[model samples]
Target chain A: MTVTTPRGFRAAGVAAGLKSSGKPDVALVVNDGPSDVAAAVFTTNRCKANPVLWSEQVMADRSARAVVLNSGGANCYTGPAGFQTTHASAELVAQQLGFGAIDVVVCSTGLIGETLDRDALNAGIEAAAAKLSADGGVSAAEAIMTTDTHSKQVVREGRGYTIGGMAKGAGMLAPALATMLVVVTTDAAIDAETADRALRTATRETFDRLDSDGCMSTNDTVLLMCSGASGETPDADEFTSLLTEACHDLAQQLLRDAEGSEHDIEIQVVNAATEDDALVVGRAIARSNLFKTAVYGKDPNWGRILAAVGTTDAVFEPSALDVAFNGVWICRGGEPGEPRDTVDLSGREVTVTVDLKAGRQSATIWTNDLTHAYVHENSAYST
Target chain B: MTVTTPRGFRAAGVAAGLKSSGKPDVALVVNDGPSDVAAAVFTTNRCKANPVLWSEQVMADRSARAVVLNSGGANCYTGPAGFQTTHASAELVAQQLGFGAIDVVVCSTGLIGETLDRDALNAGIEAAAAKLSADGGVSAAEAIMTTDTHSKQVVREGRGYTIGGMAKGAGMLAPALATMLVVVTTDAAIDAETADRALRTATRETFDRLDSDGCMSTNDTVLLMCSGASGETPDADEFTSLLTEACHDLAQQLLRDAEGSEHDIEIQVVNAATEDDALVVGRAIARSNLFKTAVYGKDPNWGRILAAVGTTDAVFEPSALDVAFNGVWICRGGEPGEPRDTVDLSGREVTVTVDLKAGRQSATIWTNDLTHAYVHENSAYST
Candidate 1:
């Protein structure tokens, strides 16, 4: 998924050999045109990784010349040395491309704390710069994945404009702004402030709402760059809509790739007094281990749902609450609703709806069920 | 344990056939004390269980004439009727024992949201009254367990008195308190206010520090009922010391009984700016699934510990942190420590020390590891 593959801006992805597997691990996407608009959202974790730290400082400037990502190291908890290594990494790419270091954004994913191979990193930077092309976006997407089973790339074209993005995360990963590193390049001309506003708004409804394992990571980042190469700038409202659609596509891809996930479980909260209440209730159910376990076992356990919701501070009359699993109301008003035998759970996607019946607010959170494979995979691997 | 087993009271554990396993499920304890002395602590979960609601309200009277507990059904989220069931249950026990209804406290645990069988419960009440004995603590203890592998009970003899208690929880039960129901009976005399203060302080060091699974329960309650029958009214200070010791013993037992737990992990966060910061750091590590998984595998993965701590807003510099897993300094100043082979994790308990070069405050949280058996046990059973 390249910017030029969409409509106006050209994109590129290349094999920079940053990973020990000799896989394409370094990716760079450059926006070419007069209007070089950009915005970014980094992880909210206080103890951010080196790449995130660098991107955070640069994101304040509201413009990005390049997005440089490596797949084999997270560069977290490596102390001051890690930050310097990250800075040098960006410098390698920026100097090669004749761009300032500060205009370049950096990202990494893999084992944390270990020092990166400076020579290999610099070599990869040279290769990436030389391999840069509008058609390299797909290769760039493949280079950023760590445990993800597949590459996630999406492109949607509109009237003389385009939105294309690539994301990578198998979701032991959590982020306040986004789950993983997603770079969305657009030929749709938009202001940096508009991109930031639309990205934040779309993210809360998209990436942020997907709560795979509830374990927030230190290196999650999402960068959006806009180039006016299309020579056609749309209204801010249209750009926001296009951004939302792109975010929705990437969000779906992240959920689909959640590690060891079998069923994609969604908890939809409706009729709450506020979106915060819906989120509180949704998050309460999303983080519930018992509830997740039941879903993994393919059991319509509505009791745990009620119990989890009751644990939250959201005010609601127990008698007015209702819960449904797979469209069948298993519990209503704190009493038995439909029979359990009628509810099916063998599907790949399950929906658990909790109606507050208190007001008119709603939200949705995507998650996965607890499974034996999840335990087997995660228990053996150290964080 | 029951009050009647301690010299001035009668107790009974009878079969209402409430548990699917056909284990004795209904228990009653009565206090025929010449002096009433009592105190209690309820769950911190805002959406409390039915028993929590009843117990908190009754213990506020500073006197408990009787307590009726039924397993196999946690009368929670049963709405107004669930509240009414507790009232009716207490009324039944109170009527049978000729004790005032307000003097009776009620507790129920098992599956959440299930209604109690009032008729069966009433019959068990009569049977328990008939079978009341002065040494029925073990039977009562066994009847209260849900998934606990064994009943936890402890006894300590004091000067001219004794402190005996029983608890039911399998560590995964986070007492928000996790499904905890504790009953401590003593013959020493202490006023209600003194007992409450001592109980709170003791819990803060003991029950409140156990975070095994970090999933807060809505039905946790701890009740202390003193008969004052020994005619040995100790001073406030002496009474508090004995209570504290007894609490320590019981709390340790629960930690050891954590379900599917091969290693009982004790995480101590020390040298902090405040006790609250210590607790925050302790809990962040305690709740980390990756850290717990490493503990289960005996891998001494210290990076997970650093990753977890750094996620918190607590004022601990990454370079100023040191971590010891089972006495092996795996990380110092947020970097690799002395190289050492793996520790023998076959032992029943594991200890982790996270030293923050900050202040003098610290906290300890007891937890179990994430094992394959845990996933199997939880996933196989639906609530």
Candidate 2:
């Protein structure tokens, strides 16, 4: 029954009273043996949450024994009072779990600027500690979610190594709501620098390409910990591959969980003059609300697509352009190709291919369709 | 009673069978003059409408005597067939108005695709020709509106000179949703190059700065025509001032027309490292949906402001930042400064100031708040 994807680690999740829905909202995970070799990436947003700030400093030391995460409140922009609240929360978790306060990472997600009920957080931490078990990974994954309809978790085993991770976010997710927090545990006997490099490279391709509504969050981080329990350590290539698979698996899940989303868009740009130009055009279309909504309504409104790409200063020849939506050639050789009614859009996934017809460079961007659910979830959800 | 602020121009608007609502959706204005002077600019979007493509080529010859505009449909991306439709529309206007087809410019707003009713359009052209008058400017203004609750007309008169214009677009509009088409007529004598330079500079600062929601349309244009009938032309400096005044006036009208737009936002960036950086930062913040919705809710949420700014690579010390929402210093010197609840936000306009505190550079980006009406209008509308 143990769900521990990595050796030398145990985790737990418990009802923290932090979420008004009475759902499990607090999780604690630990590297029980050997040194907890870790490397972390933090959100680049200047307006950071207290947990991010605390974790940023602690992460500079490149090691951690435990991480405590709670959903339902993002203790951010609360100034000195909020930071102290974060410090106290971490201290309480570390004291209960027999880990040093500096070695304990803390995270909170939900409303911003609200004070954390210290009594409730304390009880939650104690309960999580008491409930810690090898089979508690799923419970921990269930706890750290906000506005997400499902849990996002990924596990991989390769080269005598195991990699497991969990993530949470839907909107306020751009390269850097890329404010995603993920916990990756491995017993691969890997070095901290290796883990950091693999994680950054994988994240740049996966999470960084998700431009859902183009809003960056203040509390985003991806923490990877290597317990170094496995005696067999793979080479750089093998280790990087293992970490990338884990990151990719989680990235797809994040796209699937996009709030009230019906369509997942994968925009591929090919034959561009440069990779930079391809991405510029791809992201421009991905960030376009009109284009997303048009696709949502099953309207092959290719004009909006052309209009979006046209706004960019990139060197694209309108006459040389060819565009296809959902495999239907809408625009070819710079003119209308066929009626949109002929385009089949019964699939949940849509592929928009743009041939810049320039010099063969290419890139892809992923996003979700704009829907009423997205607006409702963002506008009405008080959090 | 003469609303024609510019001398020597006969302007009028008449209903064409374009809008199903029975509202006036077509307008025509003639620059009858002792001197025919003209210059124009079109949307930078590469995927342009038929009118824009036709007019850009026409303006290269620097000659246009009368302009016809339709609001019920935008002839964009109709392909070669669409190109023929524009040609037919212009030929009829030219024949009836006693000018060559090259002398007449046509603009269409409303839905895209579908063909124009040729017979109705021909008749509408004749009707507008018969009704053309110097005193008919008001009715002409009324005829050009679509989704705009008011007719935007502005008259700027200086010492022996004048600049008058009519425009359409809601205040909270982005470049995409707002297919801004403006026609300005003046009695001042100026060269085509001068007119083009003045118009480009003025539009860059005035219309381009209004980058709310970052929506760029296929048929955005500003047409300037000089009749030179008053036989009085100002000095170079004086003419520039008159043009600025006219642009300022029209800009106000456009903002006033913004859809269900409750608050007008002016985001001023100062002390940036570079002008480009200033523009990039201002535009980034303006395009941010979360910050926009927060302003709509009157929350004065400064953290969202900082988060938006952080997404840009424009160099700034997060700890050295300062922000004021509606003139209230919410974040001072990079941390929460004072409670912004005391700030008055009931006014129709709001200004957010961000100081990079890096160098001597500043810019102001005008935008509109994200209201429920905006969502409703954009969502419910079929086009």
Candidate 3:
């Protein structure tokens, strides 16, 4: 199941020599709806890419007809010429689809500080527009991948509607967003305000919690579009829950397929004074290179975990904290407890639970261990 | 040169079965002074080691007779018993030196979450006191090393006095201090207040600006002890400058020997609205794993550098930023400028200069590249 699983949506992917590999590098998704509604979130990074600068304007009116994304060139930090490229790409898509250029959103991923071949991108967009179909969602998901090992897609059913999503990200994943491009499509009768609220809530609980690495990217974007073809006005809470579930599923897929990652570690910080405190502690542990490498080594090194936790201002007594690895309490009251050898970390999945001993609030952050492969993959090439 | 290089200071390093390899694991530096004035800085991390917790109290009175340090066990997170070990070590050193236990400072570094062998540590301290000599500086420096490949020592001559310092740290180097133990001795006639102010000023400009791997330790300590034996009370400014110079030399040595590092990167953020803004931006870039890996790859990837700069709230227009690798202006006005191929990163040293174009303030941070050896060394075994 993919974005096209929702009704009144068409998507297509094509190659136009934009990538040296000659692979599919351009994707287009169009919403033919009785009511066109859209919402989006972008990277908090101040260095916005040219396409992000363009798409933020298109989303200002809370309505969009289509989204075009490409890989192989991010078109960021390329000055005025880069802005012109993004403008012309949106204009070409609008002209072909009989819509105003202001209603077209664009996204790009790959090398930054480089320009895209205008003719190649235009030809790919033209070909994608001609091939748009209900069954083309998979190709669209594949087209936007840069270093992802596989395409990620998820679908969920609401009361009487459907929600579908696709995402691509392999590295540079951190809080406030990762180096990801996500698109969610729905076949429900929802207003733009409801769509915006649901999208923010869903992402806040899902995509924002996946911190594969401590690096944030400059071109992260997540877009949600609604088409009222299903003729079902689902409850707002019900729609939001399903949307969150879909996003969570896609986030897990991205985490599992993160570049060169061997172990997927989930850090759960519980009993904090506030949800924000829990998140702060969890993220601190998630971003610790020492703790990540210890996990990769399969060593139950609770010391590194506490060292990371100590770096945060979250409410917790250093002497009263507790830590568990795979359900074994390796550290209790901030001292050695159960034998560390009792904890096994050979599997691909690892869980680190921390008790802040402050309150009842809690949060969880997903991260990957630092492995040799990760360093090799990151240092051997540019992405 | 080391702490013993200063007149009126005696140092010794000895082994007493504390280390499995039988390498020296304990060191003692005694200040025989007309004035026993002392000032120190400990790790800002809340989860401090037992020795740091004890030494913080020792420095509260701004006076110390001697400093005793050990390697092989950090003596952190070991509960009350760890605290007892630290107190006992200080007591033994005080007893042998015929001083009050409260006047002795203790420091430890190595594995965390474990207790040191008290008997072995006590025996080593006894032997160190018996063997104390003026030329023991090199051996004392060697005794405090954990992952350090070699000892780091520096000597500076002021107007009429000499300052000698020794530091030990290889990994977990970050702002506010690293997993380092440093002791600075001077035979100048300075008061406790001057020592405190100069120590803070010197460390802030040197050790506090190094973010080797962005991991702060729980046992970091930097102690400055004045003997007042040289009988020359130089200008405070002159003393601070010399102390800063010595710390800078030691900081550079630590950077060059960072665990598994292949490149030493110096990030300079200039023209910020405030010095704090410059520091925040510089530290952000220094901690960016993508930028570090790019440097390791020797691919003048200016985009990664810009991405890191974009994450900071420091005053600057993203479109007006400029970046340089070494001396090559690879990105100017946020666009490609000089050809990147003209830049050379084959050397061990790399300088990344970012002009924020916000104001007149500037700051610099030192970091190391992320390499496969870093991952291997960090993951292959527990430290």
- Badly placed stretches (over 4 Å) of model 3 are A171-178, B171-178
Comparing candidate 2 with candidate 3, which one achieves the higher DockQ? 3
The candidate that wins on lDDT is 3
Q: What TM-score would every model get versus the actual structure?
A: 0.95, 0.90, 0.98
Go through the candidates in order and give each one's C-alpha lDDT.
0.78, 0.78, 0.89
Q: Which residue pairs overlap in candidate 3's backbone?
A: none
lDDT of 2 at A361: 93
On TM-score, the stronger of 2 and 3 is 3
From the highest TM-score down, the ranking of the candidates is 3, 1, 2
Tens digit of per-residue lDDT, candidate 2, span B291-350: 776676676767677888888888787767889987778887666776767767778899
TM-score, B chain, candidate 3? 0.97
Residue-by-residue lDDT tens digits, candidate 1, A254-294: 88777676789989999998999999999988877778877
In candidate 3 chain A, where is summed lDDT lowest over 10 consecutive residues?
A: A170-179
Per-residue lDDT over A8-93 for candidate 2, one digit per residue giving the tens place of the 0 to 100 score: 88899888798899999998888885857888877777678889999987788788888889887777766677789788888987
- Candidate 1 docking: what grade? medium
Q: What docking tier does model 3 reach?
A: medium
Clashes of each: 8, 11, 0
